[model samples]
Target chain A: MLLILPIIVPMLTAALLLLVRHRGVQRWMAFLGSMTHLGCGIALFRLVQSEGIQVLQSGSWKAPFGIVLVADTLTTLLVIAVGVVGAATTAFGFAGVDPRRESGGYHSLFMVLLMGVSGAFLTGDLFNLYVWFEVMLVASFVLMALHRTKEQVRAAFTYVTLNLLASAILLTALGLLYGQSGTLNMADLSRQWSTAGPPPLHLPLALLFLTAFGIKAALFPWFFWLPASYHTPPAAISAIFAGLLTKVGVYSMIRVFTLLFQRVSPGIYTLILVLSAVTMVVGVTCALTQRDFRRVLSFNLVGHIGYTTLGLGLLSPVALAGSLLYVLHHIVAITNLYLVGGIFLRVRRTTDFASLGSLYRTHPYVALLSLVPIFALAGVPPLSGFIAKIVLVQASFAQGVYWAGGIALFVGLLSVLSMARLWDESFWKDAPDGVDKASPTWKQLLPIGALTLLSLGISVGAEPLLDMTSRVAGDLLEPSAYVRAVLDGDG
Target chain B: MELLFALTAGVLYASGLYLMLRRRLAQLIIGLGLLTNGTNILIFTSGGLTRTNAPVLAADALETTEPFADPVPQALILTAIVIGFGVLAFSLVLAHQVHRSSGTDDVGDRQ
Candidate 1:
């Protein structure tokens, strides 16, 4: 029951919010719902830590036959992270979302999106993962279209079409997997993978799954849809998308790469390593070229996915820990940066940096707030991103992949340059002519304040997060406990 | 029978891929539908041809004997079809909204 509550709480919240028409009541309800979700997340995390892995089978059906919800250390940690982002974004959405959009199921859809994200993180069946992806995409499409502007609609076309293709590809791959393996449960497949070597069509199936997840995670050559669409939505939605949606893809990739494709092929790892380097260079360079604040963040989001994949590609326990840590830091920093863009939009009345300036003069507090996440994102000293980068670089060096380590450091440098460009344009320069000079209200500052505190907290308290993520990484490299806890749930 | 299903699925996939490459969003929707159906058929065919009893056990027996159908693939296909339908419906509506707002179905910065 505890294992399933994280998915259920947000769903019930969405259902309840859908029925309530009053915005005040709705906002209060959303707050209640998200806070309740965070409670569940923390409780579930501690429960998993104390009791070890937990598996909840649907309707008392036996494992390998039932739709099971598995909560391992990695999964429960992801749920906690999702809950953190969900709560932060919902609170921020209160002020960041447009008034008109808010009245029309904004909170409801946000709750549903969180449910989709958490579901994707928690599901134990491949087909169920596909369903959660669909659920997420449908809500994301509607959210992307909520603006209903001409440009937004155009962006939605690319977003919807590409994600639909990715989903179809994943579904087809899953079908093939089921046909070949005669089981959909991940634990069952892991068992088969161990007892028998790579099953029939294993390489092709792995490649297909890689392609599908790559698109979702915004890996190189398949990430165009993200930059094209992620910026058009309101900042609150963009923040959540930054925080969870792509991370879902990373989570699944990690899960599948570790469990289903356990050989850790040097060929695939090299492929992924090269792609990570390319993605970093391309993503940061593109970010440098973009003038719009959200667009730059979106492109950067794509590039950061490389670090996580590189961690997985390294296929070492230490590297996996680095990747997991990088994912957590990147999610918080990226989400907070987008929210800061919202505060900027509220002040400047435009997304273009050419027309927006002097935010430091207008609101020094907000400017300082933005710096925390922006510098954090660039991997500055004493911050979460910096620690994560050091871990990855050390792991690469330990593995004698000096070029990968060098590339990680180089990417960090480029990331700093791009971040500096934004700082100079948006904060250091004089105000452009005729820009709006509105200040953010307390309502708007509330969520930003919370997130800023989180950013600082992550940097200050990196030790616990590091220890926990590294432990989860250890679990990821070993699968018997995962398989037994899940399949043996009949006990 | 397997060859026929495989061939038809191939044709559908070819046409779907073709339509997806076109510039128009409506055609893209059709392509998406075709792709989903093609994949569904592929899954069904890949499950292998079975003309045996269902996996359900007899009233007096604990489990079915050998030579039963692979029920998992059938169940998976059913779920896929349902999910594919939902995605199709949503994408169709989204494409319509794109046309309504952007005034052209060509998916680019043409708006």
Candidate 2:
């Protein structure tokens, strides 16, 4: 029952929120619901850790035929991250989201979004995954266009159109896949694929998966919609989008590549590696060119996805663990940065660096809060981001993937430059006269404080996190158990 | 039969892409609809079409007998169509809003 709770709690909350008329009730309910969802996620993680992967086949239908949910360690970890980020964003909405947006079913759409994300993480069937993607896309597109500002509607349009194209490709790929193999279950696909040798149109199918998920993840060339659109939303939406949304794409790639299509082609990995390096370089460099603080952070988010996919591209245990670590580090650091961006907006009354200044002069505490995640993100030591980068670099070097290692190091440097530009322009310069002087409310700070503490906690307790990732990486590298868990070796 | 379906899907896809690249919102929406239907037919054909049977087992028949069309692809396509319809409806509404607010549906005219 608890296995199903993560999806259920949010859906139920969202539905209930729709009926309630009072704003305060809706707000507290959304916050309480998010915390409950987090509790379920942490418990689910513990259950998976103690017992191994958990599977639920809806309506007693067996795998390869029924709708199935499997919570392996990787999925479990991502679920926990989702819960943490979801809760923080919901809390942040208290201070940041306009009441009009809330009245427009913002909380409901948000829960549906989480439900989709969780379903994607948990589902065993490929078609089920597609359905979940649609769920998430509709929710996110609506959220992007919630304000119906011209810029936001434009952003939503681009985001929706590209994503729908990606969806068509994925469906077509599934058709091709089912034409060849009779099953859609991930575990079943893995077993049949290995037993039958490589099927026809394998590379094309893999490329289809890559194209679909790539747009979602904002990998390299397909990443334009991301930076173009992500900043259009206000901070709450941007924070969650920056954290959970693209990571699902990365997760799907990691899951599918490892479970069903391991070594589908060495050519694919080479393409991935090349694309990832380019993604990293382009993402950070573009961040340097942006003067708007949120836009700079959004660009940074695009670039950092390269590192997680880099782990998948390398396809080694230590490297995968490092990539896994990088993702965890990123979810906290990036989301928190956006939340802090809201604080900056509140204090300075603007997001543009040219007009924004002197946060350090008056609100040193907010500046200090912003600094923690910024440094962590730039791969500064003692932070989880530094540890994640070091591990990835070490793994690349150990595998003698010199190009990957070099680029990881290079991106770390450029990251510092982008972050420092924001700090110097926004915090170091003197506050311009007659700007709005209201400090951040506790409602806003509460979420920032929670996420700031989360980043610190992940760093301080980095060992357990690394251990869990390495353990999960082992399973991902050798997925026999995962296949068995899903398929049950049914004839 | 398979070849005809394949050709139709291809032509629809090509046209869809072409129309989608156009600036007009109505054209793009039509393109999206065509693409959706094309993919639906593609899945149906790829799953191997059948003329005479639903995927039901006869009463007292424990198993699906004598080459009923595979139901899964139909199920998948139906899901896609429903989802596509909802999305198309939303896209149309959004387009109307875009046009009303911005006074043009040209992609270039969007903010």
Candidate 3:
């Protein structure tokens, strides 16, 4: 029952909001629904930590026959992250978006987007996962184009086109897997795949899955559409994308690679390691040169995803735990920065760093708030980001992959330099003559302040979070518990 | 029969790729449609052919039966078909919107 509410509450709220006529009522509905989701997510996390694994077989059907929803430790953590970020982004959306410009459709779309993301995190059936991906994609398309500017339209086109193609690839892979295995339930598929197939088919299926996930996660060569589109959307929508959308792809990649396809070809890991290196270098290099604040942040966003994938490719328990911790850290840190960037844009009325400066003079609290996460993102000591990177680097060293660790450390330095540049250029420099004056209201500070406080709390409470990540990583590596629960559930 | 279906699927995929490489919007839509159909055929062929056998569970059917058409792939293909249709409709509308906003049907012409 706990496993189902995170998805159900938002979906029902979205439907209800659609029927209502007033915009204010819809906003309240969205806020209430998102808060309930967060509460449910925390409750589910506690339940899963106490129990082993929570499974909800939909439509009263059995595991191999009906769709199943599994909430294990890993899934629980992801759900909590999704719920936290979802609530924060929703609050940001309410505070940041202009109701006159959005009117009735914004609240409903926000609810649906939350539903799609939560559904993706929770569903256990392969085909059902695809359905949720489309649900998420459709909502994202509508949200990305919400403002309806020329650039928004063009960027939306690119985003929708690339994602639809990726979805097509996912469908093709699903078709092949179902035809080959005769089961779409993940547990049954894992069991049958180990003993039933010839060696030749595994490589193709693995590649197909990798390609689909690679595109979605914004890996090196497959990540062009991300930077092209992510910067043009509203900052609130971008915050959600940064926080949840790409992480869903990472979650799928981790889930499939670790759970289903265990005997992945040896060379593929090497390829992934190299790609991670290139992604980190390229993303930060691009960030170093960008003039727009959001674009620079967008590049850094892609760079951090590479760090997580690097940990996954290393395939050590330590590395995997680090990856999980990094996922948690990056989700919080990036969303906070984007929210701060939103505040900056709201005040400055432009996204370019060159045209704006000296925000410290006008909004010293926002400036100080922004620095905390920026320093954390730079992997400063005694912060969550530093702890995540230390674990990741140590894990790579344990596996004797010194080059991968070295590159990660070097990239960490570059991330700091790029962030420092952003701080200096956007907040510290003196405002030029004839620049537009800022008029910031207190409501705008509420969401930014909330995110800032949350990051500080995570940084201070890093030990418990690290322990939680280790436990989750252990569960992910040995998914026998997940498989057993799915197979043994009531039909 | 299997050979014929495989050849047709291959032909559709090839033609779809060719059209997708073109610059025009209408051609891209056509390409996507053809590609989806080709994928459907590919999935159908991967399951192997069974003549005069169905997956329907009759009242007295045994658990183990010879030459039964695999129902799982067909179920997967059904879901894929609906999803493909949704994607197609959404993309078509998006293309229309793009055309209206940009006043061009050629993807290459946009800056």
Recovered fraction of real interface contacts per model? 0.69, 0.51, 0.47
Against the hidden reference, what TM-scores do the models get? 0.97, 0.98, 0.95
Q: What is the interface RMSD, in angstroms, for predicted model 2?
A: 0.9
Q: Candidate 1 residues A349-424, lDDT tens each?
A: 7778887777788778888888888888888998888999999999999999999999999999989999888887
TM-score of chain B of each: 0.91, 0.92, 0.93
Clashing pairs in 2: none
TM-score of chain A of each: 0.98, 0.98, 0.96
Q: Please give, for residues A230-271, the per-residue lDDT of candidate 3 as tens digits.
A: 888777788888888999989898888877876547566777
Write candidate 2's Cα lDDT for A199-308 as tens digits.
88889989999998998899999999898888778888989989999999999989888886785677888788888999999999999999888999989998999999
Model 1, global lDDT = 0.85
Give the alpha carbon lDDT tens digit for every residue of B1-111 in model 1.
889999999998899999999988888899999999999998888887788788889999988977888887788889888888987888888888878876777765373
- CA deviation > 4 Å runs, candidate 3: A96-101, A196-199, A433-437, A489-491, B57-66
Mark the 10 consecutive residues where model 1 chain A has the least summed lDDT: A262-271
Better of 2 and 3 by TM-score: 2
* Model 1 ranges with Cα > 4 A deviation: A264-266, B58-62, B109-111
Error of 1 at A67 (Å): 1.2
Clashing pairs in 3: none
Tell me the tens digit of each residue's lDDT in model 2 across B30-70.
99999988899889898898877678988998887767889
Model-by-model lDDT, in order? 0.85, 0.87, 0.82
